[model samples]
Target: MSLRDRVISTSVESSADPVELLSLKNPVHFLALGFGSGLAPKAPGTFGTLAALPLVWLLIQPGLWFYLCLTLIACLAGAWICGHAARDMGVHDHAAIVWDEVAGMLLTMFAVPLNWSTLLVGFVLFRLLDILKPWPISYLDKHVHGGVGIMADDILAGILACVGMHLLLEMGWLT
Candidate 1:
């Protein structure tokens, strides 16, 4: 059965499988899948962010302004794509839809110049803040709804990570 059929049947209910979302025909679904990175059974969000590294690296190659534009596009696009995909899936913030993570990671690395060590620390910090959802991040995650809500928390986490990473760099802690 097609993904549409599967979604509509309602008779043969099944669990939300990340891989199963790939069968969907919607362009938004494909986008929200992070080009299939979200199919990972474990840590799909991490996998989606990992898939974003090369693109983020390329975006930064042109310098910060260009990177910001690209990251901005991702954030805007993520809200639309993730929102549509979640609605289609009949689930809120389904695990299979991780374009939010890609956008989040891109935002996380925005302030820092691309480097192996910098990327490593940023990754850890982004994941930590995203998972921990400190202060305003947690507040948004709880209060917000829909795609904006899904993406907002991560965006805040990225901002926090970028700030933290920048502070650490300025402190001569990591280069």
Candidate 2:
């Protein structure tokens, strides 16, 4: 049955071991769960973003166009990846479904030099915007629904963080 056709379950909300039901072997789940990083008991988003760092480092190696292209591809595919996992879990935007975080991290690092300083700053900014949910970010988070909804706020957060990172770099603050 389609997700809309069935009643959403409270199991995700009530169960203590929601991760157990999901398999890492499933490609969609693997991606949606941030390559198993989302399985973290607490602060799954943080863990998920952390998991993206190495990937981001490697992604940036191919130059700006390559990084941008891959990031775009990831963003496009994220909706289906996250949505499918959410459907299987009978939840919308489950905590363990952190593909959004991965995409957000990629966005956060956009056009920025990858280094310890930039990585640390980008990580903080993305997490803060994501956690705080200020203004339109909060609006998108609340108003949007489904996988796109799940991704929208983080996307904006990443963009904002990217802007912030650029500002810092331009001002010689991040260097």
| Clashes (N, CA, C under 3 Å) per candidate | 0, 0
Instruction: Give per-residue CA lDDT, model 1, range 60-81, as digits (tens).
Output: 8878899999899999878888
lDDT per residue as tens, model 2, 15-89: 545555579999988999999999998999999999999999999897999999999988889988887887777
RMSD of 2: 2.3
TM-score, every prediction:
0.88, 0.92
lDDT per model vs. reference: 0.82, 0.89
Worst 10 residues of 2 by lDDT: 3-12
- Please name the candidate that would achieve the greatest TM-score relative to the true structure: 2
